[model samples]
Target: MSDRITIKFNAAQFLTSAPTLKHCPPDTGAEVAFAGRSNAGKSSAINTLTQQKKLARTSKTPGRTQLINFFTLGEEQTRLVDLPGYGFAKVPLEQKLEWQKHLAKYLEERKSLKGLVLVSDIRHPLQEFDRMMIQWAEDSQMPLHILLTKADKLKKGPAKNTMLDVKRALKDFQGEASVQTFSALKKEGLDQLKSRLTEWLTPDEADQAIEELIDQDSE
Candidate 1:
């Protein structure tokens, strides 16, 4: 985390009012999400990102995270939501649709959602479902930062190539985007993510920093 940034942590189980497009944890602050396929290391990535081992529960079995779990940063100044993983699971199609519905409601209606921290296995980066989630974030006009998980399982060259491929995938999507290789097992890339997260959590300061950058460019 940035030395200059103040951080707060809280959590809640917010429900999405079905067919009505309402989501819980209704506080106006920047929200980011960690999304991916079940068993794609989403919970592990989240736990690593927050520096909290159990912040997001991890299960070897798929379909464990059925509801939206919210983790607050900066005391609601920002939220890091753990959205249930989608695709390649044993859940029934109708239930999957509801999950999609629930997620859609939050993405479209949650004014606080500022960014999405998409997690994907490096072995199969930008899988079909991953692309769809990225599309949702783009359509919602939220920034996206992809976490290429399981980096330690690959050779360094392959890992670099995977990162390159993931970046290319985002080119088809619009809005601000970035990619960072991560290994929850090794806890690599935590500091980079923390710094970027701090900026995302603090929009006013981020905006000021951007303005200063623009001024410097002009000068």
Candidate 2:
């Protein structure tokens, strides 16, 4: 849809946290996930996207979100996941390995995971962990929407170039992966983010909403 769908961010509420796949909530409905490096502003992006401050618990400390936290959008079936950040050097080796294992299993095996919103810092772009995530999405044939967060840190020209560069890098990927610049601090790209989430989490509803809008325009 060309027009952005209005999202009720306050509708989002904390669901549950699962340390491992076995402990996750039931795999019954469509859910989109957010993943990124520890210092990638993942939590800021989530809070900004949902229009709810402290929804995902933004922290100055990296690797603070060690669990896979779930947030539902009014409905229990529709969900948004905050995955533990990867590539944190300060975290213990054993714990880092454990997080990796859990993340890999969930990405590869979660039936309810419709798509992923891979958040990356625009300044740093794609790191090693981000490439691994891209590989996983490619192998699974899952749709991926990349968010170049902290775009405000860069000038307009550099931000645009970064988005283009990332898109080019992902061109060789087998699965669908889209890239866009985002600035949680400036509230940029919220509309686009919400629109993508709508398409992924509630495709039918999105279509119906588009149809309704078109009808209104005609009338």
Candidate 3:
């Protein structure tokens, strides 16, 4: 375990939303995308992570968010993308296919995409589309983090079992990824989640400082 210093992430503010990759903001910096099945609490997780009540739009209806939403974290270059949810969209199949195509284009070709943050309901994890998303990350050799969202719905033991099961299933994955249980409502695993993100998003200077701290402790 790294006894690293706490690295604070700046409050994320809404940057923009685009229906297509071409309409997105310039791709010049690191970005981590949040993806999940429809109505899987992706928006709620984003809101909770940013400590804002309404940073990302939340709706009871599935597939309410039709566009790709971007939020900048302190810096203009570092971003968190809230991608349109897959599966169970009430829209026509033709429209759903369009969303899927756009999503695939962004995931496959975006130059600045650094990682993926996959959100899934703990009760129904690793669905077909979820598996596809994981495969995309693996194909790109990018790091992926799976958030088993709505963990509060399950009992503690069952949640742990689910997380373990997911992790075990990921052993066959070809690239780097991790799985964890999370609950935006109960604020469970928030610190650990943020710490994992900090490991990915920490700037060079902050990383150097952490290294120095580690060196001093060793001395």
Candidate 4:
């Protein structure tokens, strides 16, 4: 079995915000991106995952995150990206289109992107924009993990049913796809999220050994 590195998500720090793909940091190392519609609890889930109250900046107003925000983990090269929330942002049509263009460019061309975490409200899983994202991921053959946020709002049975329904819906997706219920308020399903991220972000055993050796030499 291959060894895995434990990621320290609490150590995550704000890296930078890029308005477009061209302004993003160098395309090196692995990164996972989080995308969701406005008011989908995406920021809250990120904050919960990082064990920070305001890591991703939660606001009562929907669509406060306008740029592609990047956060660095314990490893400088490893990163978590927050893509701009789509649909329901109170921006002009031209601005929304511009944002979509940049978002598409990043998703299509970012070489360092290892996977995408698509957040949705558990009560309203797979909205119009959500399905579009899933389709895009399928077309690009990108690994997609769906987080049905706000699961605490529903009863246990409903939550499980919603998750199961989502899983069934995605069975036809040709690419790697998965769905899980999550609740930032309750920190429910946090461990599962971390496990998925670790699987995507952790380097292989050989790479880890090399990195360990480099660190030891530096020390």
Best by lDDT: 4
Give the TM-score of each candidate.
Answer: 0.83, 0.88, 0.87, 0.91
Q: On residues 67-146, what C-alpha lDDT tens digit does candidate 1 reach at each position?
A: 77776664655678888886577878998887888787788778777778888899988888788888888889888889
Instruction: Put down candidate 3 lDDT per residue, 74-163, tens digits, no spaces.
Output: 877788899999578778889988988899889988877877899999999999989989988888787899999999899999999999
Q: lDDT for every model? A: 0.77, 0.87, 0.85, 0.91
- Mark the regions of model 2 whose C-alpha exceeds 4 Å error after superposition: 1-7, 205-219
Name the regions of candidate 3 deviating beyond 4 angstroms: 1-10, 203-219
Clash pairs, model 4 backbone: none
lDDT minimum window of 10 residues, candidate 1? 12-21
- TM-score rank order: 4, 2, 3, 1
Clashing pairs in 1: 8-74, 8-75
lDDT of 1 at 105: 77
- Pitting candidate 1 against candidate 4, the one with the higher TM-score is 4
By TM-score, the better pick of 1 and 2 is 2
Better by lDDT, candidate 4 or 2:
4
